[model samples]
Target: MSTIFRASRPAFRARTFFQQNASKTTRRFQSTESTTANAAPESWMQRFWKSEKGPKTVHFWAPMMKWGLVLVGVSDFARPAESLSLTQNAALTTTGIIWTRWCLIIKPKNYLLAAVNFFLGCVGVIQCSRIFMHHQAQKKLAEEVSEAKEAVKEAKDAIKHKSS
Candidate 1:
């Protein structure tokens, strides 16, 4: 009886070991197959647009536009065209504001830069309005001057004809 028990114990251990290994292998295979089966196929457009390179290009161009507008605005400000400068400033400020909002969307917890951008945009708009008003006033003054000059020329021509 002791010899029979010893012989059967080894066989039992081997059987359990094989069963456990088989179960593990089966589970692993099933999980991989299920994941592959469940995954939806990506379209070419989706793959291209969502690729890492696409995001890199957007990030690069957005900042470049924002900074380029700023430089253009600064250089324009030095000239005498206040209205054009103000318009450029407004555009630059808006770009900065949009870029900051985009950054916030990408990283929601950061709000400091966004707030600054918003404030600057507001200031730019106000400045644009003021400059636009001044530009209009200047234009109106020039029109009036031109009309007065035309009236004076007509009066002079009338006097010359009467004297003849």
Candidate 2:
């Protein structure tokens, strides 16, 4: 009976450890800091709560824009006539201008490299209207979300005032 109890105790501890550590989602979601003794923290829901500047959003946007420019440049280089049109060229130029302005604003030490990338990124943004459009949509969505939240808080305050 004593030997059987000892074997069961180790198995129970191993099972508990495995259950605590294993998750199929993001590592941030599985972190110990986010959890409690009674229940796991709602890490997934916490993603929506933007208390401050988030690194994930910034990281995602920069890389996505950079890669988008790369794809546009490659496509434009390969087949300018088919892959890009007059409107696309204009867009690319506009994008380049924006990027150059940003680079100047940041004042990177590697000015030459930054300038080249800025121009290249502009071309890509112009070439791929889809990417640009998507970015615009996302920007709009974020703005709308902020506005809506503010409106809701204002409405709540108005209700409280009336009730008082």
**Largest lDDT belongs to which candidate?**
1
TM-score of each: 0.45, 0.30
Instruction: List clashing residue pairs in candidate 1.
Output: none
Error of 1 at 86 (Å): 3.5
Q: Report the C-alpha lDDT of model 1 over 1-164, residue by residue, as the tens digit.
A: 99988876666445577777887787654553567668899898788577553444554344444444445544554556453666566775676668567667873333444554555565566557667887898999999999999999999999999999
For model 2, the run of ten residues with the poorest summed lDDT: 51-60
- lDDT of candidate 2 over 104-139, digit per residue (tens): 566323344355567665565555665556567879
**Index of the highest-TM-score prediction:** 1
Q: Which residues of candidate 2, in runs, are more than 4 Å off?
A: 1-60, 80-83, 106-164
**Residue 140, model 2, lDDT:** 100
